[model samples]
Target: MEFKPVTHVLFDMDGLILNTEDLYTVAFQNIVSQYGKDYTFELKLKLMGSQAHETAKIVVSHLDLPVTPEEFIAQTSKEFEKIFPDTEVLPGARCLIEHLSKHNVPIGLATSSSRESYELKVNKRHKELFSLFPYKTMGSSDSEVKRGKPYPDIFLVAASRFPDKPKPEQCLVFEDAVNGVKAARAAGMQVVMVPDPRVDESLRTEATLVLKSLEDFKPELFGLPPYDD
Candidate 1:
C-alpha cells in the first residue's frame, strides 16, 4: 500500500496502550454471569471502542440482562475500582510514546474511556508515559466528542487540539479495535492497527497498516522518527 506521510498522531487507549481489555472482560463477565448470561467474544467485539454508556446498553441488550444501562455501569464501575489500578502498559507502548516525544512529534490521545476511567488506569501506574501527550480527548466524557468510535468526532477533535491544528490527512492514528480504525478512516486519517490475536482477519482489512503488536510498528513508514535502538 502507498502510505502518506503524517505530521501528527492520535492514539486510542484501552487495549491499544493498556492491557485493560481483559480486565474489562472479567468485570463484565462478573455482572452478566450473575444473571446466568455469558459475555461472549462476538459481543465484546461490538463493545470495543464504544462509550461507557453505549457499552452498558449493548451489554444489557445483547445478553437480555434485566438491568438498566445505568445500573450495569454502577456494577462495572465498582469492579473497575478494584481491578483498574492494576492496569499495565502494552508492549512497545512506552518506547514508542517516548520516541515520539523525544523527537518532538505532535501526539495526542483519543480514547473512548471517560476521563475518570483514564485516570484510574494510568494516573498511578503509567503517568509519566501518558503525560507525553500534549492533550487527550476522552470521548465518554468530553462534550466536544458528541459521538464515539466508528464516528470521526473523537479523532477530529484530538487533531484539532494540536498546536498546529493539523488536517485529518496529516494525522496518523494508532488503534486496536475495528471501530477505532473505522473512526480514523472516517476522519480521513491513516491508522495503524495492532489488534488482539483473537480479532478476525476480515475485520482488519480497513486499517492503513496492521501489526501483531505495537512493537512491530515501523515509525519511519509513517514519516515519524525511527527508534534509535
Candidate 2:
C-alpha cells in the first residue's frame, strides 16, 4: 500500500502508549460492581477515546446506575488513584518514541485524559519516556480542545503546537481507538490504528493503516527513519 510521507506525528496515550485501558477497565468495574452492574466490553468500545466526563456520563446512563456523572467520576477517580500509577508501557511504544525523537521528527501527545489524570499515569513510572513529547494536548484540560475524540479538535490542536505548525495532511497519528481514528481523519491527518483484538474489523476500515501492535509498525513506510536493526 502507498503511504503518505508525514513531517510530524501525534500519539494517543491511554491504550496506545500506556497499558492504562486495562487499568481503566479494572477501575470502572470496581465502581460499577458496587451498583451491581458489570462494565461490558461492548460499552468499553464506545467509551474509548472519550473524555473523562463524557465517559462517566455514558457509563452512568448506559448501566442505568443511580449516580450522576460527577459522582461516577469521583468514584472512578478514587479507583484510578490506586491503579493508574501501575500502568505499564505498551510494547514497541518506547522504541518508536525514541526513534522519532532521535530522528528530530516533531512529535506530540493528544490524549482525552486531563492534565491531572495524565500526571497520575505518567509521573510515577513512565516520566522519562513521556517527557520526550515536546508538548501534549490534554483534551479534557486544554482550552483549545473544545471536544474530544470523534472530533478533530485535539489532533488539530496538537499539530498547531508544533514549532513549524504543520498542516493536518503533514501529520500522522497513532491511535488505539476507533473514535481517535475518526478524529484524525476528520482533521485530514493519516492515522495508524492499533486496535484491541475485540474491536470489529469494520471499525478498523476508517484508519489509514491498521496493525495488531505498535511492534508491527514500519516507520520507513511513512517516510520516518527505519530502525537500525
Ten residues in sequence with the least summed lDDT for candidate 1: 122-131
- Residue lDDT tens for model 1, 1-229: 9899998989998998999999999999998999999998899999899999999999999888898999999999999999999998899888888989999999899999998999999888888888899899999999999988999999999999998889999999999999999999999999999998999999999999999989888999988888897
Can you give the lDDT of residue 104 in candidate 1? Answer: 94
Candidate 1 regions with alpha-carbon error over 4 angstroms: none
Model 1 lDDT at residue 2: 88
- Using lDDT, give the best candidate's number: 2
lDDT of 2 by residue, 1-229 (tens): 4689998999999999999999999999999998899999999999999988889899999999999999998988899899999899999999999999999999999999999999999999999999899989999989899887899999999999998989998999999999999999999999999999999999999999999999999998989999987
Cα miss at 199, model 2 (Å)? 0.6
- Where does candidate 2 stray beyond 4 Å? none
Cα lDDT of all candidates, in order?
A: 0.92, 0.94
